[model samples]
Target: MSGSILNLFSLQGKTAIITGGTGGIGLAITTALAEAGANIISIEVPHDPASPLLRQAIEATGRKITVYDCNLKDHESIRATFHAIWASGSVPDILVNCAGITRHMKVEDTPVQDLDDVMAINFRGTYLCIQEFGRELLRLQRPGKIINFASIAAFLAQTNISAYCSSKAAVQNLTRAVSNEWAGKGITCNAICPGFIHTKMCEDLYTDKEFSARVVARTSMGRWGEPEDIRGLAVFLASAASDFITGESVFVDGGIMGR
Candidate 1:
């Protein structure tokens, strides 16, 4: 209320580092921040296929996009990537932990390896990014925001994808832990728990007409969420508008979990 809404959301001159910038959700967030005048730094796995198009999309918004290849599971690589960004004279003011993977398997059927893999990226990887990002911001003596890509599953019980759900649960608490430690300083950590959005992760589930219908019927919106549905919230969290907000997991679930 103190500032113009436009100014509140403007990320002009801010630099954001996003993990999984080539994916559906990540791409939407990248474009949104870019349109709001923030320079983009996308952290992705080596040899990612979606790099070219993701780059073009951000550039099309008339903002700069730099891609960094880092394995989140490898602390050294993650550290080196941030070092390179700092060496290049660009410090990240925002960190978006959007890189996540899920496997659709029942609890009984979930393999030990699958759980490790999901936890590594969805949980451990997020922790690692927050660690490095916090280190950079504290060193620079600046304020920063961290937006983690959690899921509706974090709060509600769901069938299959046990590993994914548990990992997201970890993410929710992790967001709290990071914020608890950093909010008093110069950093605010939060999460966006998306519902059933139409992305590569849901392609197979969408193919199951009955299951899809059930999910839709449960939601008051009676529709699936698009990548576009998440862009505005992503911008708000990354901007000064949400300075007072931290350590909470907000939902964009289209009323699915409300029931």
Candidate 2:
């Protein structure tokens, strides 16, 4: 293939911002984008320690990576983070809203505060980042990519995670709404629905043999997904390869949704 054709997946000179990019699936996606020649800016809360492993991984790709500690739940903090990013002279060409929290509580047992917290970080935080970064992209008249993190739970009902499920479902719809409003302005918005990835978030389940077995059986691939399994999809959505695709939810599940 010609270099021009292969350039569709190349992210040379692109700048990317990944929320919650310190560990797990977020870190994997960040490294993949960096390997594709995009400079990475990782955003996480102040209290969260930086991931040395992730820093090493990105550096191994020979791409620049910057880490910012911003409280996504606080609007002022988000704005301040954006201002700093602007001052640094690296405007983001891709934004990935991957910061989120999940509480395992039954609908009836879920505390109101817990519900509010989930919505605040997952949905609200995602929205604020998009709104702020999106405006900058629009003002610059640049084509940008946004990939929001949703979950398979958004499509299928799950037990003891009503708030989480609801929040992710809202994220999927929010991606569509943003895509509809901004496609004309050269922005493509999409959501990624992952199914039971073996990250720290699911360490408890993985440790439980019976539960792990059941989950493995449920997946057509007969195994839980790894964080790296999501990298390719994230790269695709962030690159020109997916320019014509918008307002779509691409599932990275191991054929679990089909079963």
Candidate 3:
């Protein structure tokens, strides 16, 4: 079944919708899916263009990367972006919800707006995108995949970022709820729970030698995860290889959870 197995992981002729696909872990996932043979449609904020290096990387994969500007925090913007994507004649086969934000503040000190902002983008945005993606798939009677970007915080609470932790927890369960409703409709929903990956989101913590050392010591692998560490699973979950999987949260941590 070697050949069949390879075929299962192939994404030829597929199109993927990836939010925040210009940088960091999102960019990693975009390149991975493209290299696996899928065309990409990225949704980013206005005025945020993919860097030349990133554009070249995707171009080198012999796949196209088209970006649309949308404010994930805005309901109308999300809907309009999807409509624009469909109007452009691309039928997305996969959806990767990789955009989110966090702030390091004590719950008592965090303003209500801060918590709302975190939830607006991390949880509500994910749900809205999934809502739009699911509608199109169901309307066309097609099979598709959804890969949500959850965090280790979803499983284990962390210090000073209560809002982010709670939002991710919501996303983890949202994956299950979505799968239960849409799995029978030829759509698969799941999440990727990253543990201490070396991305911009964790830069603040990583620069602190003491905290970084503590993270490394706690993780069984004795190292932090790189963005590229997510490539294989991103492709697998986006391809037919994971057809039997849904409502699951797979970790790409460097054995952090194992300890």
Candidate 4:
């Protein structure tokens, strides 16, 4: 029984393609997967400034690493990237869609282009990656896992980030829609809804003492969540432990939703 349980979390033979792996939470997830024995394929947009540091860190783990410059909004580019992965003879067993963007403007002041930009990366990009990965898994007749990044904003509204909130809400449902369509074919799709995690994305907001105190006071944990707070769940969702879980949006929001 102990051996069987241990096997549940083992990712020894899996390969993972993680979008936005150079980012804070994404890098933490990548490290967690590597520690559990999965090879890493870190994908980012072209000329990402953080890639070099991320590559070095992943290298320190002694796990296999491949870097791809992928633009998820461009269907042609996405197809090519997946094709290149297949050509390398390392089909992905897991995909972590952590790539997203946000614009901090109220609906009244937000420009149309900004909304479109957020949707292009956060919504359209996630959908395309899921679609392409599902195709590849279907072609190979392999069971696969897909983890999408939603946010606490998917359920609750906050100020000045309407575009981001809307995109995440779409992603929350997209996870369900994809699971309904693909679960019978041996793919499990799910989303992780995180709250005010301390990432580069939230640096400015978290630095504001007044706003920070308000969030912390409201949070059941009374502290901001760190990137590392997300890694353990990521490993579980990507492993055999969560084979029965699909089409669900799990919250890692420090009880924000409960409140």
TM-score of each: 0.97, 0.96, 0.97, 0.97
Candidate 3: list runs displaced more than 4 Å. 49-51
Writing each residue's lDDT as its tens digit, candidate 4 over 115-203 gives 98899889998999888889999998999999999999998989999999999999999999999999999899999999989999999
Q: Model 1 TM-score?
A: 0.97
lDDT values, one for every candidate: 0.91, 0.91, 0.92, 0.91
Model 3 earns a TM-score of 0.97
Report the poorest 10 consecutive residues by lDDT, candidate 3: 47-56
Residue 185 shift from truth in candidate 4, angstroms: 1.3
Residue ranges of candidate 1 with Cα displaced over 4 Å: 1-3
Query: For residues 136-229, what per-residue lDDT tens digits would candidate 1 score against the true structure?
Result: 8888789999999999998887888888999999999999999999898869999999999999878988778999998799888998899989
RMSD of each: 1.4, 1.2, 1.1, 1.0
In candidate 3, what are the lDDT values of residues 93-179, reduced to their tens digit? 999999999989998899999998999999999999999999999999999999999988998899899999999999999999999
In candidate 4, which residue ranges exceed 4 Å CA deviation?
A: none
| Runs off by more than 4 Å, candidate 2 | none
- Give Cα distance to truth, residue 123, candidate 2, Å: 0.6
